[model samples]
Target: MHFLPHHLADLAALAQMALAFLALCLVGRFVGGRQAQFEIDALAGWGLLAALLTLWGVATTLSLRIPAAAFLAAALVAVIWPGRRPDRAAWGELGRLVVLVLPILAIMATILPSQSDIFMNLMPNAAYLVDHGTFPTAGAPDAHSFLPVAPYNTQLVPFLGSLVIGGFQAGGLALFTICLYLMAALLFARMLVTPIDGADARPETRPGWAATGFGILLVTLLNPGFVPRVAFAGYGEAPVAITLLFAGWLACRAMVAMTAGETGRTSLVQLALVLVALVNVKQQAIGMLIAFALAAILVAGYERQIGWRRAALAFGAAALPAMALYLVWRVFVLTRFPDGELKPLPFDEWNWGNLAPIFVSMGKVVVEKITFFACVAVLFVFLERRLRHRQLDATGKALGLAAATFLLYNGFLVVTYIGHFPGVMSVEAHSFFRYNTHLALLIEFALVVTIRNRLTPWLASCPSLARQAGVAAIVLALLVPVGFAKRLRFDFDQPQPVVRQLALQLAPELKDDDRVALLLPGDTNSVDWMLMSLLHFSAPRRPGLDVKPWDHADQAAFDEAAAEGYGLAFLSCTKGNSLGLPDHASALLRHGADGWEPVKVWPYPPVDPKQRWQPALAPGPLCRS
Candidate 1:
């Protein structure tokens, strides 16, 4: 009967793989379009499905034979399947897409705890919600009740985790992330179509759509702060970025439809929903809101058309509830603090006056942080423009506006972050880079659209050798760096300091309600926070006792605990472990009569705490010291 559990697990894993594949298929169908979209979608669908099935087979509790068969079959199919065709131009486009997705995929794949470990943190919330018949407003307090002031409640991300956990799968975040990437890619490709209708300077070509999509991927991936975020940590920004880009496409479509004879209400409604959802994803999306609204207004003014009023209304209708939700959260939920201050910096901590300084910092950001693919986007913009006429289109203008808006937004962000960045750099630096990447995605999307009209003719006009060389260059540019970066960062591959090891070692000897303090001696503060959060396995009332340098009371509390003979002690054993504990505590685990017994220790190296997280460019590292 217990073996049946293994069989059932195998079945469940298979089903999850099938589900992921089906989702990819649907995405390809919706986003890819008629020509390469279908083929590409089908290939992606099958590849992901195969990968999923292989993973399931490998993980199943079934005898190794089942997994062996699954992996062998998948490998066989992949080998036999048509490899990427040798069309250099098409391959070049595909290369760009891969480059764009790498950072997002890397972060999504890594950054979080292991699937088994994540369940330890996420399941309690889900079970509580299911038991209560609703999602709770806060984290659990006592074993049986909610906390009065839950500091680290998993409200938003946990719900998504819960949905996946309910089904006993580890891929919800991955699937959601993948879908967002696919959605943005689709929207970007569709926008590529809209500007192709005219004999304007840029003419439609086979490479056009690919170039456009590739461009979007490049700018978004290479965004100023994106690399740190992806290479290091994920902040649920990728989906939001994808959503906003999709919203831009929808808005672009609605505008063009209005320009043409189609003023259907459905399109307007869809447009509105996208806009509203964009607003809900994050408050900083306001920059986008203003940009899109202004773009709409500008389009209206340029055309002398009054009908855009209805379109704008539809967009507002979709957006209003989200806007209101944000206000409700801000005014009531988030802002109900002492003196009405939100406490956490709202819309990030940057303002307008520090643009010059921000730009000054760009040399480091661009050189050390920016990816090669992103640089290609800027190059492509120049190349595409030179190849065609000198003028920009509506898409170009809108993109220009979006880019300018982003710069303005960053200027504001720099001002706010100025106070924080007094010494080295502020945490807000990462946030600014992350937020600005959104605008970069928008600009990249617009550039792609403008150039989409002219790509085919350029390819047709060029010698096959030239086209092949260009394509080879792009492929080399994208693939080589990806290989190097993956090796350098190893985001998904790096194992976190074993929290379970620490937990198991510490938990067994201690009586219940034992208060344990976690202090990082040489690591960044974020690491301490992460470790404390992970320490929740004990169901502690206030698990993470961060012992900062200035807290004498905290030291006194440890002194009191030592005098009282606390049951067990867990010390951060890393070299930089500075707990204000004497050197004897480090060596002997006890100070004459003051320091507690060191029953267990976990070796968490002091990671650089102040690293940036730019989801658009890269990921930040997990700082769990």
Candidate 2:
């Protein structure tokens, strides 16, 4: 299969991921035994992969290349190990859907790196790893080298891509994200169809279950929050949310199985690994993890399925891996990145007075946004029946637990946003919808699972109409992205114009030994950081070129760099003023003594002419007298 040079990186990444998937499956089989189902095996495999990556990241941070080498060796061993395959019927059924969905996913992954977050942090972090082969430390020269308290378990895909492609490839990293999304969707579909103990698994029920599972999968795929974030933006929240969903689903399954006196050792182990991976993926996951654990305990207690002692033991077992991984990362952060503390915002003084406005704002968002309101409705619908029916079935318990987790998740967000920004409730209001997209998916899933049985009879009665409706729904779901496509400016076939212009303007003037101080704001979405990444990616062979963020407070560093014969680069918008010039650079520019003159200003495409400015590059030597 002949492939373009650019496509080779993504292809290699996909190949490596396939290898990793196989390895994970083998490891899962080794731990969970041959009796484990595909869902259990898949979750277990992902957990093992997460654990290995966690260890790998720590090792990289410590500058120990041995673990990376050991991981490759382990992957080889996993590939060689013989393992039992999934149930033939189940595999065949799901394989068809996977095949249908894979190409769309591939296309999305290819173009996904254009999402701003990739440029903001994920890409930079991955590029740093590719360039230096280690995590940023306190001693790192650039102030923005490593974000404080940012858990980089999510960056594993990008790191792995860098390893596979022999450089940083955004498309490759995005493919990894897409795989996680697909795996989550696959597991969700399998969970819906797979019967719990005492549930009717007859041929009649199979079709209904299959239809329900397809519905769930379609809804998840069509969700504005799930696929877009997973495929394009490379948000850690998507992976964390989906992993937690799978873990919660498994926990419910295990609880039901345990009640029936059937032990689910593999399920429990898989849950443990996923929870651990969740903690490592993002800090917010810690709260979600606790919520899931609590829901498990409550469900077990409510059902009186198993003894409290046994239930506690199972939950604790599932929590062990996550707890251990947390401790490991905690120690690593303390020793290596002491400044990496989990304090993004200050906790306001205890006050009921502070929460009222926040609650009002949150309520407004939930009601005003169609997507958020629909999700809220779904949660309520699931809760209405499940709460009233005290004599709950396994499905009821699962749905109930999911609802509880969703409620708890929202509560956590409320506390976080209100406590952190007491005065600016509007800020939380803006992000409230975006942040809760995954929670919405969980609610929708719970709603579908809970109501599927009731709708199955109706669906079976009108088979022809049902078939037409299903086809139409799928077609509509597929077409929905067309509306979104207009908003997306990125082209999979072409280089980003900003990147091209930055490279053209800056790369030639930048010498191997030159240190270029970026003149840009300290905002999280600063375009200068993206410029730095583009420069590094384009000129990988150029050594000893340091690109550091310039701030007014860093006057001494700027002065020292200028004194030491370094270069200065200013980023601006083609239609607007420069992002901001540092005080030292302004002084040098005014005097015209340091050869700080206007270089070529590269124009970039603007998302919105009114709000966003087109990227412009201005580079000059800072040290020339």
Poorest 10 consecutive residues of model 2 by lDDT? 616-625
lDDT string, candidate 1, 1-625, tens digits: 1112233443432344334433334333322332333223433333233233223322342332343234334434433344522235544554555554554444333223332212333333323332332322333232122221111112222222333333423233333444344445544544544452232123234434344444444433433324433322222355445545555554555555555555534334544544544553434555566656555555433433335566456455645654554454444324232232213344455344565566666545655545533643564565356436733344544454444444455555555465434434543255444555565556555556655555746766777854574565455434544454543232333333343344445444444454544433344333333344444423332223322211122355456545555434345442333453333122214334444544334444444547433221111112232
In angstroms, the error of model 2 at 54 is 2.9
Candidate 2 wrongly placed segments (more than 4 Å): 1-18, 35-40, 53-95, 131-134, 140-149, 161-165, 196-224, 227-231, 344-353, 418-430, 461-500, 520-525, 538-544, 548-566, 571-594, 598-625
Which pairs clash (backbone N, Cα, C closer than 3 Å) in model 2?
none
Error of 1 at 446 (Å): 1.3
Best by TM-score: 2
lDDT of each: 0.41, 0.57
Q: How many pairs of residues collide in model 2? A: 0
